[model samples]
Target: MAETTGGVIDAAERDLIIRSQAGDRAAFGKLVEQHMKRAYFAALGFLGSHDDALDISQEAFARAFDSRAKLDPGRPFYPWVYQIMRRLVFNISRDRKARGAKLEAATGWIVDDLSARALREGPAARLERSELEERLHGAIAGLADQEKEVLVLKEFEDLKYREIAELLEIPIGTVMSRLYSARKSLAKRLEGVV
Candidate 1:
């Protein structure tokens, strides 16, 4: 069977893409519903604010839909969407640099329930854990942009070294080195706190 332009072209998403390309607003809406959360989360992780995430996510889908005909039929869709998102983040970072704005903390360290439980043995322990999360986030914010990007992609997004290299257009070795440095720096910073 022939594949469609939306990549791997599952029945539902393929139908939606086809309808969307043909100017079906409802189909496009459905497409947004399917992908928006993932897109928003990716953007939030990169850009670090709800407002910026909203703008970046909306821009990415709009750009994707506008250029729908160029999308490959055999690849996964999220990678393409993520590329758009990364471009938006780079642009945002550039603008912030031009305006002399410092990189801000994207969010608190995302401790899962198990990690939280392990850290929080009592009320005082929980408070101490929260303070550590804040300090860790501050340390992350202090990292170089490339280092921070590498860490977030590898740890939070669970991207492989090669995947991160491709996403950031760096060599795999560079990704590994940056991740190593980031982890070492974070560990040193969080040593006594956590």
Candidate 2:
């Protein structure tokens, strides 16, 4: 694997990129298969709508394919695809806000299998965890879009500070700052609950 500005690019993925750039649908499908879930979740983190995320993620891939000739096989693929998806997520989010539509809280995004754990910890513990997750999701949803974006990318997507910076095209310090602000806001929101 070779490290590029985007990230690590394995040989197979690089070949897929090359073939994809040559207008090979199967190669492009392979690329999409690698990234589609992450793309949808990334959009969901921003828009908080499953339907919107699905649509925007797919649309991003379509647009990416349309501009396939511009793809650089040397770099990792997801970052480039993420750039496309991010724009669509933001545009739709802004439009919804402008029209006074409430962005749904991504309450369902976090999933923990509590059935077995519940047997061990009891129903009360499960209920508490479920409630905590709800509160956390609500607090996260209430964050400013920038703060939310940084938080989701870091905490949920599990991207490193450098990776988040590269993905968002921002400085690492900015990413850290936004994450700090997000944490503080979440703390304030969950002060009593937690």
Candidate 3:
């Protein structure tokens, strides 16, 4: 999905945005319906926790609604809401006193893809997979937030370089470079498993 850069808009979404900005309840609901899931998953990938993702995403939406007048109809709604979500996540993650506790609370959002062999090969294989999954999660969690943000947006969200750059307000080359550095770091950490 291409985002509206420089406040460009398509007609249908433009109508929704206008109505939403005008305090139309149903129109705002429509906007929420369209973007909530994306916002949740984006928060999940950024914060590395299910509960924080749900709470923060909802709060971001609420804040967006409260600040509806500031919304530019010519811009895409999701990206606008996304900015709010990202800022909340960043602030929480950067808080020295709360960061460790938050990280501890953030497990289980990242699930390992259990293979069919987990059932067939029984306990040992299952244990190994579990260990590797935990290790990989830790490795990923250990990355600097910027690298992790780039990795999550590109790999987990499946965003294109341009899209990631646009969302991050950076050049496309910077997005690719960050992703490359993130992958290299993750690979080094996971070398034992793969």
Candidate 4:
């Protein structure tokens, strides 16, 4: 019953949402299984540490379940759960900034998928790739959180502008504007290297 542009989740998902809203833990578990990885990665893109992402994603689900009564059956579940996760991410990020703690660069979160290709390269090529990744990560880390969030949703999550707008509860124009700013900033940061 979660209304969507195409169709409120398909029958199975809608059924799970209904059951979850009815206090069915197993149904909620199923929903978690469907979304856990994407949720974790989204948090990873924000927090930059595997452990923190894992903890925040799990905690978000816990909060979501605790507030199950507020879940609208006519809405997609991930976005609701995402709002919880995003708040947790922003809170921790703000705390870290206040404490002057820099985010640690986790080895695998962002660049692991390229490992096979990297392995085939010579040491010099691999080193160059590693350096580029480091610079890119540093540049992304320097972005304002709002710009970073929009960039992550569009680039890493591969969500379309409309989807990103819906997820962030912003207008499509805002999503485009933020994305443009993020990309422009990155381009300037990476101008010489790339």
Identify the leading candidate in terms of lDDT: 4
- Expressed as tens digits, the lDDT of each residue in 1-194 for candidate 1 is 31211235566666666777778889878878777887787776666677888999999999988887776544546667778877888888778868877545444424556347846598787777677767776677666667877888787778788777766667899999998998889888888885
In model 4, the Cα lDDT at residue 149 comes to 94
Question: Candidate 1, TM-score vs. the true structure?
Answer: 0.73
lDDT of 3 by residue, 1-194 (tens): 43543345677888898998888989999888888888899888877878888999999999999999998877888878888988898887788335465365534777645744575779999877877777778777778888989898887888888888878889998988888898899899988886
Local distance difference test, per candidate? 0.73, 0.83, 0.81, 0.84
RMSD of 4: 2.5
Question: In candidate 4, residue 154 scores what lDDT?
Answer: 82
Superposition error at 144 for model 3 (Å) = 1.0
Candidates 2 and 4 compared by TM-score, better number = 4
- Winning model by TM-score: 4
Off by over 4 Å in 1: 1-15, 98-120, 162-171
TM-score, model 4 to reference: 0.89
How do all models score by TM-score? 0.73, 0.84, 0.88, 0.89
lDDT of 2 by residue, 45-109 (tens): 77777888899999999999999899888788888988888778778867877887765645666
**lDDT preference between candidates 3 and 4, better one:** 4
Ranked by TM-score from best down, the candidates are 4, 3, 2, 1
Off by over 4 Å in 4: 1-7, 112-121
Off by over 4 Å in 2: 1-8, 113-130
Give the Cα error of residue 6 in candidate 4, in Å. Answer: 7.6
